[model samples]
Target chain A: MTVTRSKAASIRAARRDRWAQRLVQCGLHAGLMAWGALAVYPLVWVLLTSLKYTRELYADPFGLPKHWKWSNYQEAWVYAKMGTYFLNSVLLTVGSLILVLFLASTAAFALARFEFRLKGLVWGYILFGFLIPHSILLVPLAIFTRQIGLYNRLGGLALVYAAVGIPWNVFFLRAFMETIPKELEEAAIMDGAGMWSVFWRVILPLSQPALATMATFHILSAWSEYILALVLTGTTVSRTLPVGISLLEGHFTSNEPGVAAGMAITIVPVVLAFAFLQRYVIKGITAGALKG
Target chain B: MRRGRKRGTSWYGSPVGIFLFVFPAVGVYTALMLYPSLLSLYYSVLEWEGGPISAAPFVGLANFRQMLSDPIVPLALLNNGRRLFLDWAFMLPVALTLAFVLSRLRRGASVYRFLFYIPVILPATTMALLWRFILSGNDYGVLNSLLRMVGRGEWVRPWLSGDGYVQWSTSFPASWQHVGFYMVIFLAALVGIPEEYYEAASIDGASGWQQLLHVTLPNIRGVYVSCMILTLQGALGAFIYPLLMTKGGPMHLSETLISYSLYLLWQKKTWGYGSAVATLSFLLGIIAVALVWRFGRQRESALYR
Candidate 1:
């Protein structure tokens, strides 16, 4: 009788433990979902608010719009000049991506493959970029550019972006290139392929993953860059989206829905790019944190 | 560079080739980043209004004197300090714990990561604008609306426009987006711990909490140090939030050092004093980083011992 009683008690205890385990699991998942809501709700509210008439915006902050006011987007794009800002940002992103990849990748390839005097000096020089606070650098850069007649031009801004990225991009790609075996480059040399051919044919093709990572990263930074654009670009002729969208604040407080639409416009491309390039971006962040 | 032309040497390995490869990058970097930064050192000690044509008379520490006497300089510095403390107190612990738990998950981790990381991708401008709307003074403001619905109308105040609330209100959005950023960093660090460590701990009859204390936290010390540096830089370089949200006002209450320097540079055209302020702010950044490094290295040795 004692043996039977002990077995029954053990079974009950085991059941209770399982119940507690299940409860803990449920709580964990619930907490995760709640945080997820916190992350997503503001973005959703902005989207919903953009579709409302300005009157309905204050009347119902959380509810769905009575009418999906597509005109908010139309007016923001046409009247609010987000279209112009959007184009400028696109031009800047593409232009800088090309310049950055070429400059960073070549410098990285040479630094990785060649032994030369001043290599350490070169590395230290570029690394010094990180030491200067960005705000301090801006005033001087603005003065330099203005003297040269490039101050307010998108082309000049693109050059600045390319240069700003050189420090980290070169560091990252050089590290990546070092991992790529030296044997491949020697084989290409044996085939009588000259330096440019080897770099173009072997190194560049091999470094595609790192290049893609930097290209996306550059795009993100250039697209979102503000203070530089604010200090440098004096007019709508060259203003990027972030700076342009912000300029609306002083003049268009009544056009809150229009600004919401403008915000939506600014974000859509980022969301789209992020969706497609999510894997590379995640890899970029990990590498950036670990290696940088 | 002529070293490349030696017999049996690879063309790319030649000195000329190396110079060619590195030149454009180095030149552009020097022109844009390094040269400008060096020029700030010169300008900080000069009396000049910013155009090329303006005479830059050497001021020799006069701007620094003014910086010492300025009231807003300390206020701006304190604002950055408050931000750093708030982030460490709230964001870092939450991010670290979330990353730790998510690292242990066998399923649905990707979904949560995706959800959490979406905010990190948004621009500072978008975040500022979104939060401004959410925290607006009027009926459209989400927080105030909620308070009214709960019969606590007395609690509602103009978040950005009110007398004392501007600083915290601007800080809220800047801090909000960073949770995902630090989480991703910590998550990467956490995911990198070898399964063997956990197995060994379990073999020794260690519980999960014990393993976390003894094994997990020690492993991510390097990443945490990196996070600290990034956090400090983020705090000091905070410009967009106060600029867009509050315009550093009702009366310059929310000004960061950077925004205040921008005002001195543009609106007031005190270029010399502004350069001085900017230079000092950067010096503070370097000193702050050095302190973090000093403590980080000290703790690292203690951990090993």
Candidate 2:
């Protein structure tokens, strides 16, 4: 009878432990879900609010719009001239990506393959660019751009963007290039390929993944940059989406829904890009951070 | 001998090839980034408006002296310090907790990770604008509406309009945006831990919390230090959220060093003073980086020993 009683006690204890574990699991799920909700709530609110008429927004800030006014986006795009700004931003991002990839890859290739005097010095010099804040350079860069007649031009802005991206690009790409075996290049060399052709054909093809990652990073950063764009470009012709949207906010201060629509327009492309390339973006960021 | 000579003449060893490959990047980077940085140092000592560089008169150490005496400098530095403190206090533990929880999950972890990281991908301007609306000072604000719904209406105050709450209000969005970033970092570190460590701990009759303490945290000490350094750098150079939300307003209460420098240059048009402020900010960033490096190295050594 005592043995049977002890067996029953052990069963009860096991059941209690199971219950406790379930409770903890539930609590963990709830906490994580709550955090996820907080992360997404503001974005959803803005998106929905952008769809509401002014009266509906004031009536219920948190509610779904009674009538989904997609025209808000139309107005923001056409009437606010965000369309033009959007084009400029695309141009700058693409232009800068091209320039950065071409220059940084070539430079990284040379740095990775060659042994020359001043190699460490040059590497250190370029790496120092990582530490200098953009704010500190804002004044002189503005002056330099103006002096060089590149101020208020999209091409010039793209050049600045490329310059800004090079240090990190070179740093990351050099590391990537070093991992490519010398035998691959040597085989190409045996086939009578010059250094340029080897890099262009052999090395560049091999570094596609790293190049894509860096390109995405450049696109995201250049697209979202504000202060530099603000300082450098003074007019609508050259102004990027972020600066234009900021101006929209100022111009239509009381028109909350209109401004929110503009914000939504600015964010959608980024969101779409992120959705498709989430893995690459996350990998690039982690690799960069860890390497640094 | 002929093959060796041919190999030597190839592009990899050729000086012209090196020049062609490397000079463009080096030249542009120097002309744009490095040169301007040095020019900023030079400009900090000169009494120049936004005019011809040659026209400006050099006032050696005057801008620095003026900056030392400027009352706004202290306030801005203090605000940045407060932001760094708040971010470390709030973001680190919350992110760690979320990361830990996600790491423990068996399935759908990627979905949770994606959801959590949504905020990180959104542009800072959009985030600031959205947050501005949510924290709008009036009755129509989201927070106020929620408070009223929960019968806590009395607790609601003008979040961004008043001096008392403006700093916290401006800092919140930055911390919110970056929690996912640091969460991912910590998650990566957590995922990197070998499975055997946990198995050993469990075999020793260690509870989940005990395993975390003994196995997880110690293994991730290096990553923790990196996260801390990144957080510090981010806090020091924070510009966008404050620029959009407060514009360093409520009588300069929310001003950070970056925004303050921008204000001095853009609004006030005090080039030398602004450059001086920028130089000082740069100095602070260097100092912070050095301190973090030393602290991390010391802790790492202590742990190894």
Candidate 3:
């Protein structure tokens, strides 16, 4: 009789544990759903508002529009001259990005592959640059650029971008290149490849993933930079999309729809690009951070 | 150091080869970067308002004295304090909690991680614009509308405008936007913890909560310290968001140290005084870096040495 009673007690405890587990699981799902809604709500509101006319947007701010205004997108696009800004942005961003990658890669390769006197000293100097806030350089760089007659010029800004990017980029690429097998380089050299040839053919191709990672980061930074653009360029055509988008705030007083449309116009292409390239971007950023 | 590679051709030893290897980097650093940094220090002591260098008058410590007396300096510092507090309050815990939850999920974790990371990849301009609309005072704002439907009508207010609820209003959206990014970083740290440690703790009859306290916290302490340092530095130099959303006001309430300094130099053309603020910012940055280095060393000694 005592043995049977103990068996019943064990069964009851097991059931209680099962129920507790179920309760916890249910709570977890509810919490995640709430968090996800919080995340998605803002973007959804922007999208829906962008599709609504100004009249409907104000009249029923929270309601779905009876008629969607597809032309709003086109209007925002043309008003901002975002098309021209987009082209300019692409040119400048790509130019700066290429310069950053080439300089950073070569520097990183030298630091990683060669051993020399004061190598540690050079590494320390490069690393220290990362700690200096970029904002501190703004005023100084502006004056310097103006004095040199390079102010308001894209080529000038590209040089500045390369300067800022090279430090962190070299640090990151150096760490990555450090992991590449020395045997691969040795094998290439034995087959009569010179240092330049080995670097161009073997090492460069091998480091494509790191290069892509750096390029994507540079693109993201350069494409969205506003302060530098605001300070450097004066002309509307020369100004990039970020500054152009800021001006959208001035258009249409208390016009929520217009602002939303403007936001959507700038957002969609970038969001779509992010959506596609996000995996690589995440890997790259995380890898860079971890390597640090 | 490999034995077989010792006698290989010394391409780097040639004079032209050495120049090819090193000159480009050194040339860019010296002319474009280092020279300007030094020149800024020189310009700081001068009375010139961004004029040609030759026309400037020397005014030693006058700019520094003005910075000390400026009311905008304190106001901006106070604003930075608020930003730093709010960032620590919201971004830190929310990120840790998200990492914890995301780590436990069995399926679709990568998709969710990618979803959260999208904002991180967006240009800061787009991200700022995205939030500017989302937090606008309109009843159509997703946040305000949700509050209304939930019958919290009294809670809705102009987020980026007006003196009412100024502090909480601006910070919430800013924190919410960046939480995903910090969460991803924390998640990376979390994932690096080996699973066998957790299993061993469980086998030893430690409960999940206890194990987390004992094992997980200790393991991630280094990450926590480093991230905190990064976030603090980012907060100290906070700009773009407040500049875009409020232009640092209903009454200059949101203007940060960096933003105020930028205004001084660019808007008012008080270039000399602005350089003083920049100098202060640089000093603060150095202090932050020193603290991080010290903390890293202490933690390394505790954990590994």
TM-scores of the models, in the order given: 0.94, 0.94, 0.90
Fraction of native Cα-Cα interface contacts (under 8 Å, chains A and B) also present in model 1: 0.61
Q: How close is candidate 3 to the true structure, as a TM-score?
A: 0.90
Over the full model, what C-alpha lDDT does candidate 3 score relative to the true structure? Answer: 0.73
Task: State fnat for each of the candidate structures.
Answer: 0.61, 0.56, 0.31
Per-residue lDDT for A239 in model 1?
Answer: 90
Best-to-worst TM-score order: 1, 2, 3
Per-residue lDDT of A1-292 in model 1, one digit per residue for the tens? 9999999999999999999877877788888999999998877877888898888877777889998999998988888898999999999889989998999889999899888999999999888778777788788888789988879998999999998899989988999999999899888777666777778888999999999888877887788888888888998889989987887765467878888888888888987787788778778878876652
Worst 10 residues of 1 chain B by lDDT: B1-10
Candidate 1, which segments miss by more than 4 Å at Cα? A1-19, B1-10, B50-54
Full candidate order by DockQ, most accurate first:
1, 2, 3
Tens digit of lDDT per residue, candidate 2, span B199-234? 999999999889989999998888888888888888
Give the whole-model CA lDDT for all candidates, comma-separated.
0.84, 0.86, 0.73
What lDDT tens digits, residue by residue, belong to model 3 across residues B77-126?
87777777877887888888888888777555676676666555455665
Number of clashes found in candidate 2 = 0
Which residue pairs in model 1 clash with each other? B1-B15, B4-B14
Worst 10 residues of 3 chain B by lDDT: B1-10
Q: Which stretches of candidate 2 lie over 4 Å from their true place?
A: A1-23, A289-292, B1-9
User: What DockQ values do the models have?
Assistant: 0.54, 0.52, 0.38
